[model samples]
Target chain A: MKRVIFGSSWLPYAFLAPQILIVIIFFYLPAAEAVRASFYLENPFGGGSTFVGIDNYKDVLTDDNYVRVAKFTFWFSLLVTFFSLAIALLLAVKADTVLRGAKSYRILLMWVYAIAPPVAGLIGVLMFDQHVGPITDVAALFGYKMQIGVNYNDTAAAMIIISIWKQVPVNFIFFLSGLQSIPKAVREAAQIDCRSSWRRFWTVTFPMLAPTGFFLLIINITYALFDTFAVIDVVMKNEPGSNPMTLVYKVYLDGFRGSDLGGSSAQSVILMALVLLLTIFQFRMIERRVHYT
Target chain B: MMETTSSNLEVEARAGGRRTPLLSQRRFWRSVGDHTVLWLGVLFMLAPVLLAFLTSTHDAVTIHRDGLQFLPGDHFGETYEAVLFGATGFTGKATGLVMTFNSMVLGIGFAVGKIVISMMAAYAIVYFRIPFATLAFWVIFTTLLLPLEVRILPSYEIVQKMGLLNSYTGLILPLIASATGTFFFRQFFKSVPDELLEAARIDGAGPFKFFVDILVPMSKTMIAAIFIIMFVFGWNQYLWPTLITTDEGYYTLVRGIKQIIQVWVGANIPEYGQAMALAILAMLPPILVVVVFQRWFIKGLTESDK
Candidate 1:
């Protein structure tokens, strides 16, 4: 005990202080404040808050808008993850096989990925907005009169499309690397055995990509849930829509606009809990199926 | 035995099929397919950007006249001048100067502070074995679990309380102590061999000496990669900066450019040529960074996979 104590006595604490300080100041304290505020009914403008345990959470959970937002968050995450991963895998496999200009293609993809999400959203607004947007003009070439920016539903669709556009490149990079790391001989032998391209991919390529896919699935879902909501918020600010805002947006609306700090905090806490549970579940269940080698 | 052998040969020949064409038909077709798909994907990705570029180069009056043309024209010089120097007779304050300054301060402060502080912290954590280090680390990393947006309101309050509102400190401070950077540097430091440290110690090198001589020298590539990524992330930050910075002088490039688009679209549609030029300019630095670090970025991504 003495030796262990001596070995550990000062170093860890001293070394860890800076990091701990940051977390306390930036993360933990804020989180605690949020949780505390969630139980208190207060006006955001000024004055002290009164404690009202569970009421905020109850109010938010029972609200129809909240339920709608939760459903939207779920559906958005599910579809984005599914389509992004699918298209990414397809591109990766094709890129790996074709091998011509692959490097430049990958780099270009990352360039797009590096561009800001809000910028992308803004660009979407420019391109698709009804009055005199280029996208509207382009659509007119095909005799389709689609008003994108003005309509909340159309805006959401544009958001999703842009999300996919920006994301495919990064996801493709991950999947391609995963595919490339698998030995070429396994593929050659499979091919020599008269296995069709589709069959070989399903049997060989897809299995190898499981680990990358799993990581991306977790990260992308989290991103779509939390990060993209802000972009959507900016895009849809004060727009009329039953366009089904996500839980994150609802939190933003409730907190910043509604000035119901408690309700917003409750919603945020629930969001955090949902993410944690899902992440833990993923690690426990999906990690086993991920073929690391 | 001879019949069986002949049959096997015939089957193999059949599987091989007809002779490849002069250019090797299979290879040619495969190449065609590859090029087509690649070009298609590239076109899809580049189309909007190209359109925006075109629109920006064309004066607003002509844009409505031409209606979504991609060809470059004389308006490039005109629009470029307007975007940089401001429209000769437009209402609303010019945002170019404010945006550029804000972006520069935020990017430099965030990137430099993050790298320096993270390096120091990472060094201490890996080398010193401080008390409650694991717990401390867990606490630090727990911040990563919450997206910045999650606790943004409280953070806003905190910044307001600190009187950091409309200041560069507000933009820079929140970004400085990233868990991502700390974790990255820790992983890099942990990979350094102990024998090097012992040898350095024998040579009378202290912790600072050892770090400056050994660790930083060996970790240059990682540093470059981290700097590029962090700079890009900082430069691209929008919501927080937008929320905190109410002053026209504190608008970042993104906010400024976005405002231009909004104001142009809302009021005078003719100023879009200038808006497009500014947008293109705003995009250049991040693009250049990516281009410069392309090789290191790929290697960094691949290496971290392990």
Candidate 2:
């Protein structure tokens, strides 16, 4: 968009070659192959595949297990996005109120953003380990037995909790900044009109935070969909039948483990559509409302 | 001024006389509530790490027998030594050190490669008037949605066909063409003042000279910010390396930690101590980067969102 320019056509192309090459080779080619393969029944081995138009998609759409996995992924993404946003909003509001030690609190809450999903998963597994988990000891104090590995609900709960924990720091960073960006004068004006803190927050602060909330909603869903693949992989490695098998994980499982290339390609294409829709929605709707100031 | 001061003093005295106990109590409770919530958040964040570190210190027998120990044990030195230099006693191929090295290579390679390519792409798009430039930009931008998870099978096949399966290039290159980085750099470059470019042109500096001198220097903070993000991302890659690399020498720390936990001896128990140590090792570099570059990290996130 700049008016000032440099270089001829060939020079620009030369500059673009490396990125274009990689994108085509790694991204476009594979994406094209996935789309193409979705329509064909391919052998798991390197043998040639037969074009079975819409059959792979039909099988995936009708498969009961795929339905279950899709349902689980929907609920998982919802719960993670909701709880992480709510918890982060609470923490950010509280941290914003503190007149002292706010920096230390922010630092403490923020460093966890650096921990990878797999590491967070390992931490969750260790904390919830039935035999050696300290959380089980705490649960014993409450007179409840903690058996995460054996119970599907418990395993699903662990995955959700870890996903929320890993995601809260990111949401917190955004929400805290959002809260700070709401001018003090606006809050004070509201305070003069309405003395109740809760009412003031609802009428003034929450509406002001809508943009950030919407943005984080999209980001958290994207994260829950894709980024939690490692977390689920680690937590459910021993319990593959657990309820936390998201669509992304299912793609990997069906393609790599089940060796169902055509089926997995269908799943992949479906996931791509879902992500593309979410991304387009985010850029179109949510981005327009984001208040930069 | 005297009238205003006296009025202010009168108001302060009247309020102080009546509101002291009620206001002090409310303020005390509010402070207490804030600190309590903040500390609870801190505990939620740090407890897992503390427990991981604590469990790493103890011997596996004690852990297996007594469950997770809250207290630190005496095996810290020995456990870390064994994890770093010693073998897992099952398949003694990739040690903790070698895996760490591979992880470092992958992380640095991935970050540097992404930065270089994206910078050039952004520079060309922002500074040059090439044909189909907008189309090219959109093509790169659309990649934001096409993560590896969506195209895993074919991507793996493509890398395999390229004979880069076990090499660092295979591990890093495919993941390096990032839409986020290019998008970020394009925005950053667009913000660079036009006068700077004009001045450089007037100075008879060539495009390469202007880029290496003025642009790269100006982009140092942005580079640092992206470096922190991309390094952590690259270091934590799990599925890609797992799919591509079959050799032990190419194993990264993140993948290696999972392997340590999964690798089981026939009769012996899993190496919980070593696994914990490796987990801690894997966490160190990224945590260090975040802590060291905390300012730039936050800045990058905020700016990129804008």
Can you give the TM-score per candidate against the true fold? 0.89, 0.94
Q: Identify the leading candidate in terms of lDDT.
A: 2
Interface RMSD of 1: 5.9
Q: What range of 10 consecutive residues in model 2 chain A has the weakest lDDT sum?
A: A236-245
TM-score of chain B of 2: 0.91
Give the alpha carbon lDDT tens digit for every residue of B235-277 in model 1.
8887788678877667787666446544544464556566566
How many residue pairs of model 2 clash at the backbone? 0
The residue ranges of model 1 lying beyond 4 angstroms of the native Cα positions read A1-16, A138-144, A237-244, A285-291, B1-19, B87-94, B261-265, B268-270, B302-306
List, for all models, the DockQ compared with the true complex: 0.39, 0.60
Query: What is the Cα-based lDDT of residue A43 in candidate 2?
Result: 71
TM-score of chain A of 1: 0.89
Model 1 C-alpha lDDT per residue in residues A92-188, reported as the tens digit of each score: 7767875345676676556775667666666666677676677677688999786664665666677677677767767877888888888889778
Taken over the whole model, the C-alpha lDDT of each candidate is 0.70, 0.84
